[model samples]
Target: MRDLLGDQVLDLLLERSKDGKGGLRLTGEGSMLGELVKSVLERALEAELSSHLGYGKHDPAGHGTGNSRNGKIGKTVQTGVGPVRLAVPRDRAGTFEPVLVPKRAGRISGGLDDMIISLYAHGMSVRDIQHHLRQIYEVELSHEAISNITDAVLEEVRAWQARPLEAIYPVVFLDAIVVKVRDNHSVQAKPAYLAVGIDTDGEKHVLGIWLAKTPLDHATAGESSRFWSAVMTDLKNRGVRDILIACTDGLAGFEDAIHHAFPHTTVQTCVVHLIRNALRPVARRDRAAVAAELKKIYTAPSAEAAFDALADFTASDWGAKYPQAGRVFEAAWDRFTPFFAFSPAVRKLLYTTNGIESLNYQLRKVTKARGHFPGDDAVVKLLWLAIINIEDKRARERAAHKEKTGKIKNSPSTARLIEGQRTIGWREALIELDIAYPGRIR
Candidate 1:
């Protein structure tokens, strides 16, 4: 390539790419070194550009403004990163609003800050992520700075959680992931439930987040129905008139909770959860083989075929040792079969808790580092915020739909979207939850 293209050509390429940081120069031994040097310079500049932080009168970042003749601070631009640059406004009136250019007091891009928020969602401790930022980007990020970035999600979470929802969700997937939270002034881990609804329009939206002090303490004990009941009440208040199908991980009373709340909802067990539970009972060495065989059950061409595989599984060598695992299958057999009711596209989406559990995995990554939250409010705040930011990536998973008319995609449409209240008649089928979870409907 060097032989074909002269070093002068490489030098010209280097000059074009450089943005005033040291331009690349050809070294004594190397050919076209200047271009490589320019590339490094441009990348560093791009990195700083991406990390630019934002500012405003209500900036939560706590970057206090300074006094100037026109009572204006330097202006800066926001990039994909989390930080904002303080571009010096040309007009002393501080009226200039630069869109994508350099400004005074230029700071690094906010992307690292954005990453910090994501790491927080993944359950990284601010202290740890701060240290992480230091190690990764060599930036001295403060706890408050990191917290402030993540806290921005709270406003978004609040808006989403309180936003009016669709009247009916044709299919809803329910699942919970436990994360440690500071509860009751003690740092303790809690189970936070994540619910996702596939609307009649085939749009998947996360309904809300619910937290439980402990998995054992969730709803089964007479004291509280856990966060599920509260979530149900919230849905009702928000006008969730009907829920057609509910998929879950067979969490204790989760099905019952849905049954009681929606009354007519068809509660299905997550096929994936059933598989995981079934495999747990198999021997470590033989588990993979057992799982392979078990896969035939759910993955079979039809429910009949799946049941045939199930029967075969029961007759297999591992059945005795992993009997309880098979029972998990037996218990969920009715719920698991619902997937067979839908077309392949819908069936694949509904049979598993993939929609909600993926969100939960994101939730766990954010909350995992914290041993526990301060209290129920703190738990609620963090989880709600985490869900919003996490779900913001929803479009990546979604197909192109007609854009809606709302500043926020999750916000309610001007025209109401309530659906028919066709009950799945689960109340007569499942146990009735007499517990009343009281809360103001948003």
Candidate 2:
């Protein structure tokens, strides 16, 4: 490459790259690296134009070919290191199309869009991104340009949201997290509902994400029957014909909503939610004892045994003192006891919605940095990007762990609902599910 540029040009580049203090400047504004990149791209565009015209410059192969070089067009493009200006070659016929830096493209390919999206996914606001690029890459981008770049993924998000789903998901978890969005000229909290499904192959997948239009006004406002029904209907329309078990965080009317879409899907209230709700009213100091007492009901060997344990707890001192705690379990007992019908392995998988909760936790970390979003689209866009970022990060961690340990870690915490990563203990769980719901496994 240095030989191709000749010794004089290479020496000039090296000399230009040297800082006044005797160090080298490889990046940032006015760096020789940017100039070198500019030269390489301009040369590549010229080559492409030559290929398009079927001749080299001033070759004189045919003087009367009726097509010739016109002049160079100046264009500026954003790059990872910085922005570079290029002299794009044009033709007399206006037929040349340069593939290296296509006409009207403000940013070059090769991961600039991806980098911006990744940064946005990790919770960097548009202004933050602008500052980061200006400070680190010495590239100045307008707010509108940065927004347009990130907004390009809205189409992808729509396509993904409308994509067909599996016919049969052995288990599906429904949950929602609240996010602040601008509405009615003020910021209001809204629910972002997510559906995660586990297919018959034991692989996990996030079915879709929906941002409810109704702003949350109270604790239960985010979990509504109408919104959840729409979500369930969406899954059904997208090809989810059967779900053997639907786990939820004990949202009001959630059971009826699931039944409305998939009547055969057994609604199992999330044990963790039940426990948390039960412990919420208990004194913090007594929570440990209350939780310990509550565990006996869930861990009981059978539904009848669980009921007996519940009765015993209600008669105990902790249950009498915190009667609401016992009522929390009693209210959810119908949905809660479904897990007792399955084997212990299956029960472990069906009893909780931890996978979706973990995903929500990650999404919150991304959204928490921003006090509020401008609109629903902005919220959806950021959350979608964050989900992609999270799954990618998890995938990298899994790959790294496998490389170092020569074994994949099948831990519950790593059991994400995307990328087809199998949930821990799913194989054993599936066998029990097959027995529990004979024809549903298919």
Candidate 3:
């Protein structure tokens, strides 16, 4: 329903229902708002019939047609406020299908659908949603009814997964989270891969999601490479011709797969992930100092400086005791030092898989509620719904920020100014990319 129409109807109801004792009064059973909604819906149904018949009521165009309106049929539909009795138009040919509310739909209000979807997205289970409806709206819906409503988004998820992507993404962050799904009647942990991309304009977008074919113990080089190869192949198939930088955790074989998929793409290991991994072998008493020393490498002015710091760290007491930590850094040195080549702004984006990691955090909240999904599709559906809600919240935040700062979200040049920063490394980073990659930016 149009917001303006609903607001106008609400205003009319409130103004006419004033107690006339200079105070507001409650609009009960035959309330104007309820009646107005019923009237509008009935009129819309009539309009649908008219269009299907190719003429207005009693018009000459429908005179000889066998699809002319027969008479009105009584159908009591449930609305947000209460049950509304509507006289639906019917035709002789029975070809008129109401687009506003399908014939099989008992509840006709858009408000109810929004409420159900919002509740589901907020982590309410099916039973919890049903309870909310019953307790608040006094409407008892069957399990089938609620399932049908939520399952309607399956096709949406499918289409979103298959949608074409941008030709070029300056940066893409890849990561995964484990979700339990039923496999051959037994539940098992499976990885769901997420790719988040930064468009040419600096806005963030989720590229797509992929579920690994097998239940891998960890994101090993062989396993991660195979999974990422499939993901990159799909992205390329969907129009992603080039990706400049890919930020990822130290998943073995990931960098090689990236090079093979998008030959020129630079793969940066998430410095945060490296820090976390390095801290694992350090003694708790020495963790703080070890973390402090590790920070010097990532935050160093250049790769040479970072290497120098690493060399110094290896000779330190903590490094000698927790030699594994140094070895871990050494193992991923190539991927870890790529961020030092770029400006701080670009480094801020490329130095971590935190983009997709944050997304995984949100997905975890929803998936955690379900002990195990019935199947992979169920896992995808819940995560997809959660992603939609997350994106919506982010959009609202962006809009509010724009209202407060009067700066557009997509404006790369003014973004730093809006963010109250001296430089937005992204623009300069793009220039460096153009010079480095040659013809890849456009």
Q: Which candidate gets the maximum TM-score versus the true structure? A: 2
Task: Show where candidate 1 strays beyond 4 Å.
Answer: 1-124, 128-153, 213-226, 299-309, 343-345, 379-442
Per-model TM-score on C-alpha atoms: 0.57, 0.90, 0.75
| lDDT string, candidate 3, 10-32, tens digits | 78777765655856544222445
Candidate 2 accuracy as lDDT: 0.84
Candidate 1's residue-wise lDDT over 231-281, tens digit each?
A: 788999988987867777776756666678877777878888788877775
Q: What does the lDDT come to for candidate 3?
A: 0.76
**Predictions ranked by TM-score, top down?**
2, 3, 1
The better candidate by lDDT, 1 or 2, is 2
- Candidate 3: count of backbone clashes, pairs at least 3 residues apart or interchain: 1
Residue-level lDDT for 110 in candidate 1:
53
Backbone clashes under 3 angstroms, per model: 46, 0, 1
**Cα lDDT, all candidates:** 0.58, 0.84, 0.76
Candidate 2 or 3, higher TM-score? Answer: 2
Candidate 2 on 1-442: residue-level lDDT in tens?
8778899997898888888898888876557788888878888887887888788888887478898899998888899878887788899999887777877888886667778888999999999999999988878888998899999999998898899999999888888888888775667788787888888888888888887665445432356688778877888899989988888877766777888888888888999999999999988899898899999999999999999999999999998899999999888888888888877877888878887888899888899889889988898888888888888777777788899999987665454446587777888888888888898777
